[model samples]
Target: MEPVLPLVLPLRLRIRLAQGLWLVSWLLALASGLTLLCSGHLLVQLWHLGTFLAPSCPFSALPKVALAAGTLALGTGLVGAGASRASLDAARYPPWRAVLGPLLVAGTAGGGGLLVLALGLALGLPGSLAAGLEEGLGAALAHYKDTEVPGHCHAKRLMDELQLRHHCCGRHGYKDWFGVQWVSSRYLDPSDQDVVDQIQSNVEGLYLTDGVPFSCCNPHSPRPCLQSRLSDPHAHPLFDPRQPNLNLWAQGCHGVLLGHLQGLASMLGSMLAVTFPLQALVLVGLRYLQTALEAVGGVIDEEGETQGYLFPGGLKDMLRTAWLQGGAAHRPAPEEVPQEEAPPKEGLPEA
Candidate 1:
């Protein structure tokens, strides 16, 4: 192996940078992991809002961004610390000379990924998600009963679940259902004439009606709650929520769920943003550490390369590197002169 080159940075400064990288990397990973873990389930549930939408969810890639950020941050920090050690004692970390090169390249790629992630958060993720949910929600209502009779609508099943789980009615209100006996929802798509005909055929003569489905009814509402009339809400004058059909939820599911998803998107964006600067700093430090190690004769593998040490540099390559990197890189550190005087040459004797 070639002799180690003198370090570019002072020993104490390099140590400080390594310590900082390690500390920040751990903290960033912990924070991102916890935040995502707590909210991931809910985010996944809301992603269903984009299920029926054409082209699917625009924010599908959003959730994984946090995970990637955390992973990269942790890896970069670990590599930085290792590079620092290699700079001090290259022989101990024999493989690092090869490892550090690839890691630095990966860090560069990771930085680009972070930039794209930031753009996704800022430019269009929340809005696209909301739009998809809105369209999907409406489609669910229109196609509620995907059958001849009112019993077997896959879309309706999801809608009912949404209503019950969120304490909501139709996309807007209980009135959105229009009538209990009829499945001809106002949300019916005019383009699908067959679906419209099927829904109308389900409604028959002499059918009694309730204002909303069971899912929209409050748990405290009387058993088999039917919101045709009977209950006098004005009797109390000031009831909670104060809507005409007091027994049934009057609000829409769209606004409530959309708001929640928006909140989640904001949080994801914010936390990701917080990590951005720290990750950037770590990459910078990591690059510096890589430089120091390289200066100390570390053999780094370039991007897509594995056998840097196996192949020696050609005469042309060394000259190219020397010229591009200021001959032997920058000025040496002011620590101490590493060179020793060569032994004096013996005089040519009796020529």
Candidate 2:
């Protein structure tokens, strides 16, 4: 078989191709970043929850890394687009060139980070991530406290956030709360004696809470179900072995949370597939633009017409010959002022 020849686009077509492509790429990049950020807010809560683990966790860091990577890429893309447009200013070329080094560095780092994330997702996420969460969540539950308990409030807040946001209960199910130390260790505050008294009275055995957290209650459940000894009406003040707990969340948080992450990973994979190609094309177009900038004489098209400013003709003789050596435009020469001719008149001898 014969070797395939490269598709060489005409100079005019190449220039035209770069022309509005930046905008398209930038929009796509922005969408990708925004999607990552959408998950970032919830990740903050998980980050707090991870602190309960002796060595923290993998899932905890994933979204944070995504946030940082997306931010860096988005920022770099915005700057690059601005620079591309500013290239036409002709006055800003030096600054643009100067900034190019940092942009390249940042873009490379962000791109590399995104590639790594995509690769990680492609390899699959179930086993390690789920295992980490499964183990770390147990540790987190041991320290659970719905109210203030120095250095642990974040955990409680996160637990509640998780249950409420996911509309589920506990790590594995509402019953998981039975094994946890639900009451805060902090000294009872007089400011809210009723809640404190309720907490103290509910304690059973060494340390116990039979009912799930208030966050465990379904939003549509009656107001009475919001408090404990959280009776299911039929089994007030006592857990009934025979009856179903209608007030409590029937689903567990672990699966819902894990499934959410899987969705994000899938989304990330799709976005990466689309984004990388657009970025590559944008970079290729920029390479051509780079050549045009260095040449400073406009590219010659297949029809023999110049596509940009050129010397001795195009755009004020290449903008007043300022870019003669690919540099800034030169200033116009000053006008000559005329002097009085009295001395010449006094010595008016014929030449």
Candidate 3:
């Protein structure tokens, strides 16, 4: 058995193994490229899906179509490039020629495996996948607001509205002091009040109406109570101040966008996990094999030179050709080799 193990493989067996390895390598390269392409396409689709679903946003189908087309083109390019590179490399290096068949086969199989993994993860882990994205966006928004000055008028108005809409004022003629007719007329006669009285009344009214109690000022309150008759729900919906409709809408939108983002992230993460590390390992192995083959070729070339049968058509010739072309300007013109005078044949021992 030991002696038999050292026997050379039949030509048929050797050819089959070579074919298998080539197929595996080509498949791996193609699969890696296709996975990358699909990931990109999915990302674009996610964006277009988000925009399309947005309530107030205008939807254009062009982006979605473009994404699909781009992905298709990318996949085609990847497969083509992988096949071409494998073929070219195999032609250039004899050892790689053996492994190419197996590599192509294995690559195809691995890529198919990764595609299955990506699909499974996309189906299984969407929301959990997207949570970090939401948190990150929230943090970014907080940071941006902290660094930037309030720029828009609407922003200021929103801030003011948020602060002022829900508080209670004192019962006294708070309006008259501030020269507001509504509060002054409700409690005090403007005609009867002295200048000082009017001023006090208006200031009191403004303070009572504007000052929000800690309990009533809770921004999260769906409903807030104020210490005034005007705070009743029927009279002033603004008494609560918080916009439930807007909050609900915002929350719903956030949830939906988050789900989409999570779906995408999970799909991408799964693809990377399955495809990248495996592909990298395959590539490393291929490189090592390539180096080993080159070493063997070097030994072969040396042996061939000793035997006066060195093959001219090889990497050495190709490299020499390339070097000559690149250094054409620097290279000296070939000098003619002049034949030296032949020595006279000696007929006898030198005298």
Candidate 4:
């Protein structure tokens, strides 16, 4: 086997690696933070829709937004400190006094804390998969249909927007509202004789053939499907000649909304995939540079202080100093060292 290489790399290589890792980690962190904020915004919008029909307990995305902001702030501060430490001239400032130890400590605390929170969220997500979205929505819709007063205009607007944007019908389909008390209830479908017969029996107003909400119709459809109209008067033109029925979207808003949320989650997972490893690389590079710094010695020229050694006990010494300097919320008094009585001096009696 060839002779073993030194534990540390050359100064030039270390410097270059340190700079590259620091820059990459900082950029990745910044990008991740922005992505997380966007994801949180998507979640909050969905929550607004979910609580639209049923406003029992409001879902607020404040916590998610706050967490993202906190992470961004901490990452930015730590990266800055690490970069400052790395840039310090080895000849004038030792690694410890260059503040590398404190910076590393802060970095480790921030990174480890984020990792723990992520792990906790991942573990807890499975417990609230749907959180009664389907059941609660069905009940709320049923109650709304029965009540003629039009209780939740906000929710109705949200649903209309959702339907228009996603090209979907009701919660499941246009048929989900077939049993509603509205006059347009009869305009579900004429092809299904059973449904038609049911509507005819339950019809409170004039008998008209069927269609979906105006929002569900394609914008350029020959005949406008109006929200006020019980059914589109020109049904043949509403449908694309290729497919059956009115060419309206048959899927539900619930699934599409949930999918938006799931995409947010996936975005978060991808960010973590990039960030976790990038952070580890940054930490390792900083550590290597710090070690290299140790060997160079005597950063500051002092008569009494040890050359190249600002901290004598490594991290322990740094922590002690930080605590003494009021870094902690409550600083503890230093421990007292017991002293032994001295032996009798020449011609002098001992105490």
The top-ranked prediction according to lDDT is 1
Model 2 worst lDDT window (10 residues): 303-312
The superposed Cα distance between candidate 3 and the true structure at residue 218, in angstroms, equals 29
lDDT scores of the candidates, listed in order: 0.59, 0.58, 0.39, 0.53
Q: Which portions of model 2 show Cα errors greater than 4 Å? A: 1-11, 32-36, 48-55, 79-114, 117-127, 145-165, 180-215, 222-245, 292-351
Cα-based TM-score, every candidate: 0.63, 0.58, 0.32, 0.58
The digit string of per-residue lDDT tens for model 1 on 116-179 reads: 5654654577778667766776766666645454543566677777888888887777765653
**Cand. 3 TM to true fold:** 0.32
Q: lDDT per residue, candidate 2, 163-264, as tens digits? A: 887788877877787777776656445468665565566555324546777888888866345334443456464545335544677778778767766666
Q: lDDT for model 1, on a 0 to 1 scale?
A: 0.59
Clashing pairs in 1: 97-299
What is candidate 4's lDDT per residue for 1-118, written digit by digit as tens?
1212234345555456556756766765675575467556656665565553333432233236335534753474356445634455554444445676676666667765665465
Counting only residues 3 or more apart in sequence or on different chains, how many pairs clash (N, Cα, C under 3 Å) in candidate 4?
4
Least well predicted 10-residue stretch by lDDT in candidate 4: 300-309
Q: Between the candidate structures 3 and 4, which one is better when assessed by lDDT?
A: 4
Residue-level lDDT of model 3, residues 1-351, one tens digit each, is 111112222334333333444555555555555555656666576454332232332222322332333333234334433433443343544544565546545544554344445544545545343444344333322222122244422322332232233221111211111222222233545566453464566545431232222222335647444423332356555544243321111222234445555555555555445554545444433433333334334122222111111122456666787798889978889999999989998899779
